[model samples]
Target chain A: MTRFMDVHHGMEGITADQLAQAHQADLAIEHEENVHFEAAWADPESGTVYCLSEAPSAEAVQRIHERAGHKPDEVHPVPLQV
Target chain B: MTRFMDVHHGMEGITADQLAQAHQADLAIEHEENVHFEAAWADPESGTVYCLSEAPSAEAVQRIHERAGHKPDEVHPVPLQV
Candidate 1:
């Protein structure tokens, strides 16, 4: 499995509860695509959110995210990490 | 303390050991600025690194990162998270 860092833009003013619900939405359906979302953080002012996940492919991550209701703007492969 | 998400670019060929050393460097001096770095992940192929930290301010996070040898390209305040 490979790790992925995905970014979502234009989500300004996202609240803590909203973010948690979205994360839960992803987690609820993650197994379908074999994606495990580790964590998520948001810069409400910038309308940007970052998600860290491990999946078989970026496509899988994107699929799970899209199905969860928030599509990522960018999905980068994280092959090496500390 | 607020969580911050910092990104570092231009480190395309970083290896696992190199990444660990960089994280260690930050951890070694993080307490000086009251910054606690939670984790770091890198996309070696794209030369991008993402760092997650809790600090008094974004500046504190930046200070520790700069002292550690890899200045952040962008440091976004993470006020909302899940």
Candidate 2:
């Protein structure tokens, strides 16, 4: 499996509760794409959401986020450790 | 291979030239650990550094950063795509 890093913007002014709700809502969905959500972080001041996920491709990561009700600002593949 | 996301602080008041120098220095090193640097971003205003890498563990990623000349604030692994 490949690894992906997704950076998201447009999260400013969001409460912790709201962020939690979004995560909860996204977690409920079953994604067909080969991706696993590993970790998620939200910077309150920057309104940026950073997530690490394992997926076949960066596009798969975007698909999962779209299914989760938010759009990613940047999604890039993490090349295998050489 | 696993994927990692690293967040770094303590970059405030640093010049862009300094940041570029650090990156160049780090990129010159060869790490024994199985890790590949995917991307890096720096915010001049906020003094935050974000990086994406593929490795077997977060420590491997940190070691690479250390070899590269910076300490990370946070490091986490991305699980395999299930």
Candidate 3:
């Protein structure tokens, strides 16, 4: 599986609780798409959200997010892991 | 210019102060390469570091990281912001 990181913006003032909820939403449907939502981070001040996952493809990552109702602004493959 | 998010791993015991120092190192050379290191987040327990930046290309981002002496595991373009 390829690893990917997706970003979301304009989420300023978002609370950790809300992010956890969104993460759960992604987790609920991840299996169907062969994607695994691993972890997420949010910067309330910047309104940015980042989600990390291992999936078959970047498209799968996007699809999972779309299904979760929080489509990503961008998706990029993670080539290196240190 | 495009925005990008880069991830660094295997930093489980990294401290916030270390991250700040790394960030400063990047900032010190950002202008020469047309890369702007915006913000960074570190999860001490997970050993993960995320950096946000605006750069001319993904390579430029990588170059900045390399100069800072903390190469990223991956770099991905950020295409959407909402």
Candidate 4:
């Protein structure tokens, strides 16, 4: 699996619960791809949501987001610790 | 290896060159830890630098940042693709 980090904008003034709903979308993505959401967070001030996921391809991750409803500003691959 | 994504404030209005300097610092950390910097990016408007690193510990990544001159606002672990 490959790790990817995606950042999204336009989430300002959004509540954590709303964020949780977004995360639920992520969870759905995780399930569909058989990937894992290692970590996810959103900055209310910046309206940026950062999510780390393990998947086969960056496109696969994006597909998950597309299915969810939000489009990402950027997605970059990551190297794992172990 | 663990993948960690750190978000930092005070990066708004920061230049990509400055962010690259920070990435150089990250590279130094990767060297020290014998890890890899899979991907990294910064938003000039938001001043957020997101880095994905493969390291042994979260503290090790933080240590890299401390050595570099900027501290991370948050670090969350990520799973590997393969």
lDDT of 3 by residue, B4-51 (tens): 878888987776567778888999999999999887766565576778
- Each prediction's Cα lDDT score? 0.93, 0.67, 0.81, 0.70
Clashing pairs in 3: A9-B82, A73-B80, B11-B47, B12-B47
Clashing pairs in 2: B26-B68
User: Which candidate leads in DockQ?
Assistant: 1
Instruction: Please give me the DockQ of candidate 3 compared with the native complex.
Output: 0.06
How would you encode candidate 2's per-residue C-alpha lDDT over A6-75 as one tens digit per residue? 7777777656677677666556652577577776666555566776677877777787788888879887
DockQ of 4: 0.08
Docking class of 4: incorrect
Off by over 4 Å in 4: A80-82, B1-82
TM-score of 2: 0.50
lDDT tens digits, residue span B4-64, model 4 = 6666766767665676777777786568766666666565554556777778877888888
The TM-score measured for candidate 1 stands at 0.95
- Checking candidate 1 for backbone clashes, the offending pairs are B12-B47
Quote model 3's TM-score.
0.55
> How good is model 4 by TM-score?
0.53
Candidate 1 interface RMSD, angstroms, 1 decimal = 1.2
